[model samples]
Target: MARTVEDAAGAPHILIVGGGYVGMYTALRLQKKLKRELRRGEVKVTVVDPNSYMTYQPFLPEAAAGNISPRHVVVPLRRVLPKCTVRKARVTELNHDEGWAIVQPLAGPPERIHYDYLVMAAGAVPRLLPIPGLAENGISLKTVGEAIHLRNHVLEQLEIAESTDDAELRRKALTFVFVGGGFAGVEAIAELEDMTRDATKYMRKVTPQDLRFMLVEATDRILPEVGPEMGRWTAEQFRGRGIDVKMKTLLVSAVDGRIELSDGSSFQAGTLVWNAGVKPSPVVRRGDLPVDGKGRVKGTEYLTIEGLVRAFTAGDNAAIPDLTQDGEFCPPNAQHAVRQAKLLGDNIVRSLRGKALKPYVHGNLGTVAGLGLHKGVANPLGIKLKGWPAWFFHRSYHGAMVPTLNRKIRVVADWTLALFLKRETVSLATVEQPRADFELAALDGAGHRNAERPVSENAA
Candidate 1:
């Protein structure tokens, strides 16, 4: 069990909610800045997150493509923040007026955790639509677990396509549809497609021609973050590789594995990867904190909540004014999330010791995205790069930013070994249902060998 304010004998407690890039980085900096205070028990830091680890989301696409190990993408909270108390729970409600938050643990009843300082770093959730059959079939690439599942699911689809004699079943198995053309969707499809292409070399029945990859973007272009020129180049590259890039398209429905598009095309796809944007956590709206029209907590340039100096917020949940821009808020990305977190930590420390808080002011550093191995696009420091150079830049930037030397070494090691070893394409899909074999053996009735199957996506 972790220590609480009572265990610290009424020390000033700092509560951090949601252990993502913002939450974890803020606590880490605080641990360093307040070392003496923590050692002398003058202050206590408690981080509450539903998960015990922080995921490096930038490498999630690579993890899905098996370019990086799934475990290497996540930093263990307890291991990283030893000086602070780590509570594996979700902060469902916050009462800033009373300095208490209602946290719901994985099990047991909800508990109120009081704090002198609060950090609302709870990141965004997927902005899912009410499209038909989407909830039943869509897969997301947000976490390491989801990345692992997607890798396995894509490989399993190949296996199904190879074994099935039914042409329609094989066609569906080979078809993979990805929604959204942002970083998540584009990189996900690119990596998985590369993996599938490599896996086909070992299979006699399946070939590159048998595969069908489609990318649906509601906007006119893909990867708008990297400029219009690069986005057009990326779309052209995908089209050159025989991928169908449908711009200004919307996924109307996906009922019973059949995809209906706004372009008047219908097809059956075994995989439907949904990377359709994200919205600020709804929990922020439910709280008393002031929010913008988009439901993000309104934060000042100092990274503190509006009118509440003790309350800090960053990442996807906070709409901090971009000092570099005249009237625009900071974009919700890893680049801003990480930089804001460091500044937020310093501001918190300043508030505790009667020092002036510094406003966060950083210009856009440009963007880098990996399409696959030796294939990418980047515009770092206003310099445009494509192909191998961009790919190298992407890896170098993310490799340096993956948090903790332990994870850094592991991620780099994965890349190094990939150059020498054959790509591992085996799918452990059964891991999703570990009880299948045990339950079959335990059954004593006549339907033991022929049990009715539960309804779930075969893709993931």
Candidate 2:
């Protein structure tokens, strides 16, 4: 147990964990609604997260494809929630029974904080499986950093294939495999394949045909959220574009860059992207709070944790009941997360003021997915759209929902410029190891000095 900070008397303190969709939005609403309470010191709000920014995950594929700047996809938490106290730390332990949590800061020892209200929105992490070489070689597409790195890595592989004379090496460098057929996997592969094909126009030796993109899905269809007909259409579109959509197939092993599939196929790939799925953050189960069999904290339609009126949870980590559909729960997606957060914020304010709380009962509005520039699918209000119109709708909806006006302008500007300008395909892989060049130079300088020195001096 860490030393608990002395709780200030009179005012009730609200402590929120994680700065992603739910936490950020909840804080934003609370700060705006409780301005008078906060100013008068009648109530307090503090947000604790490992990162200071909230990533708009819907734009991650675009960011990875270089359609949008990586910086524009993330909103700074402190800048957005100026009225609330933003603590840059991760909650390592939670003891709801004692009304305290142990938080570990990036640079300091752990400390405990006490609060009257709690909000759990730690979000989810990439669901990795126990397959050979996956832990060593596979890469994920969950964060802004990962997306940028993937872009650099893909471009670098293309350069390698273009310069290499060895046919096997070239083949390996040109082959890209993606496991899973969910929205993340589908969008990532589509955007990257489109970008790579467009980039080949500038290469002297590499052509779009040389690139082999494979999507391995255990399930029979992709993008189940878009319904069966749309999923079939998506697969057909991918196949027509020269992408190998291997349905009802599984990746058996990927040992040392060599991929073996359940269908008795083996191949070498330079890039292996894993977007299988995501699991709830483990911290949600650290306390005695009730959780379902899937490890998600149980939540009521009111957005409050079950059996705990003062505690709230939303987003990927909470299994909140879906009131619109009997015996069902809300799906873990940005649309639901954002809406639940707004309602939760209002409910919390109402609860604080001794008012009756309302239940969250919003039906599924729609679903949209972008398949690279001007290609998309959407089912809004039961009206199915395809191609350019769907793509336009996808951009419009997300652009409108991307937090602040500053980011909205930046994202729109990036899209607007991309329409007229030629695609930029330069690889900056060195950004992953910024100090590598300086370190190599230092080693070379040391070698040169050693060579110039006398034999005895060198020996010494």
Q: What is the lDDT of candidate 2?
A: 0.90
Instruction: Write out the backbone clash pairs for model 1.
Output: none
* Model 2 CA lDDT for position 169: 94
Q: lDDT per residue, candidate 1, 302-392, as tens digits?
A: 9999998599999998898988789989988999999999999999999999999999998888999999889999999999999999999
Q: Tell me the TM-score of model 1.
A: 0.95
Flag regions of model 2 displaced more than 4 Å. Answer: 1-3, 444-460
Clashes of each: 0, 0
Q: What TM-score does model 2 achieve against the real structure? A: 0.96
Q: State the displacement of the C-alpha of residue 35, model 1, in Å, after optimal TM-score superposition.
A: 0.3
* Best by the lDDT measure: 1
Predicted candidate 1: what Cα RMSD to the true structure? 4.3
lDDT of each: 0.91, 0.90
